[model samples]
Target: MPYSRHLGPLTPPAWHRPWFRYIDAVPGAEGAPPAPDPAQSAQTPPADPPAEPVDYKAKYEEAIGHSRQWEQRAKDNKAKADKFDAAEQEKLSEIEKANLRIADAEKASAAVAAELLQLKAANANGITKDERALLTGTTEDELKAQVAAILKLRAPSTASAQDAGITGGGSAAPTSRAKTLAEAVAARINKK
Candidate 1:
């Protein structure tokens, strides 16, 4: 006559239901080999295969960044070289032009000097011609007399010691003096 038990009217507890369902659902899986519990397995913990090695993404990123920096430096160097080359070319062209101008100036100076020399010579010749023409206006007899007087004044005396013993054939003619005068006259006339 304690409190009447209600076991007959109550449904089964839910705690045991899942266990029963697992046991019933996996009877073939359990029969195969107890499923080899992970904790009890002797597979040597799989040795972790050397931990798959780290990716080192940061180090690779740093190396790539350095490479990019070096590339930029190379580009800058090339640009500088290009600029220098262009400037050098311009300087060279300027130098070439200067040389050409200098050459041209030298040629012009030479031409001018030649022309000046030619003009001076022409003026000299013109003056000489004018002097000669002015001298022609004098009396012919007077000019002849002056030339004869100059020749007589310049002639060696026949009694001079150098001419005294110099005698020609038979008549002792003044052949040597005449021949010398003739040669001088011929030379002077040829010079004209």
Candidate 2:
């Protein structure tokens, strides 16, 4: 026989053999059987049959009814909102009227308070209510001056005492005479 060189083994090693065999195998090799037909597979259920034609008219009518219901609801909500707005306006008007009334009452109260203060001031100055009512002066100072003039006019005059013949009452007879005249004038005032 002729000499020949054996560079490698005829069959590959065990670890390399499986990889080579897998690559060499056919798509449907005997070791791995063919996949089951989709129609006959137990895992896949049959597809549903063709559905009947849609009833577009009935569907459109139902959609229209729903739309109408929504529109009516919107209208009702708007009506309620309008009613609430009207009520609020009425309440605001009422509040405004109440505010006006309050303002008027405050003005009246201020006037009464001023009058009361004037009356108190007059009373503090020993002016009686009846005397103040008879007095006619626009201001307190004028009223006070008028009251002073009236008091001065009502006071007994020295000329009246001299006319009564009541000179200085150093003597008992003149004193008695002065006392009598004074009593007579007091009695006359009381009678009036």
Candidate 3:
């Protein structure tokens, strides 16, 4: 009461206006503070913006086209590989055929060499070509047996018996006197 009585004659300052009046006032007042607009204060901005729509069908079609191209390339590569494999298989088969032919030729050569060796051996064993031609046998052993049998059947020479006055074709023996004379002549020839 004492302070109020002392300030009763003084007026209150204009700066003591209410807060709502200042907030409601218009902007650009002469020497006045700017005021906030009620409409701008009542509304709020959005947190995020809306996005444009995407074309999923077109993207899917492009991806499928690329996948098909890759699949076709893979098929082409597989076909090429198969073609090369067939060529290689054919070459291998040809090589096998050539090896078979070589083996047959070697076998034939060995057979011919064996036959030549057998012929040489037969000739060395005193078998004449004409006698061998007349002989009949399939193998070397059988041919040798035939040749031995033929040699056995041949007659002995008669020249020596004829010199001793013993006719080989006859059954008669030399007379004692003729034998004695032949022996004496043989002894004399041996001494000379």
Candidate 4:
């Protein structure tokens, strides 16, 4: 593009512009040192003086003190971290124990509910108390099935001798010798 003098002047000058403000940049510029003469250089000593000794021990001790302070801070941070970790571990163990207790309670509740259901089903089926203890099932249908099985097992023995037209078994004479009360007690004691 062609140069535009008007636009260039409108733009703000950057920090690196106006180079003439700096001193002694180029050789042979204004304020430049005069050329040295060989005759004056051989006679005069160098311009700068010798540097003094650096305080090495004082600097070394300060550095060591700063490093020790940082080390102590690191140790304090580690101790706090250890304490937090222990607290977290304790909370985790407590949570685990509580979860175990909840699981056990849930298991026991399920077992009791199942037993109650079985007993209710047995009672509804008109089962005897002794037979009800034998009933075992997790669901109503299974309990009903168990009750039916028990009833089926004892179906034949429900009738008495009167219903079968059979008699004389109740009044039969005893074949064994009759024992007195004292002899019965003595026998019972001996058996025990």
| Local error of candidate 4 at residue 133 (angstroms) | 2.8
lDDT of 3 by residue, 1-192 (tens): 223444565444446755433344456785456676779867967657788788999999999999999999999999999999888768787779799899999999977865675476557667667655434444566556555544543435344665445564453666444554455445335534
**Candidate whose lDDT is highest:** 4
Model 2 lDDT tens row, 59-135: 99999999999999999999999999888767777779799899999999977765665576567766666656534
For candidate 2, give the lDDT of residue 13: 54
Tens digit of per-residue lDDT, candidate 4, span 1-192: 454455653433446476535444454565555667889999998898899999999999999999999999999999999999888767787779799899999999999999889878877888898877656667787666667666665465444564333663553433212223234334335534
TM-scores of the candidates in the order shown: 0.22, 0.29, 0.26, 0.34
* Candidate 3 whole-model C-alpha lDDT, 0 to 1: 0.63
Instruction: Give the clashing residue pairs of candidate 4, or none.
Output: none
RMSD of each: 41.3, 35.4, 42.2, 29.4
Question: Which residue pairs show collisions in model 1?
Answer: none
Error of 4 at 87 (Å): 14
- Candidate 1 lDDT at 25 equals 41
The better-scoring model by lDDT among 2 and 3 is: 2
Clashes of 1: 0
For 66-97, candidate 1 gives per-residue lDDT tens digits of 99999999999999999998887687877797
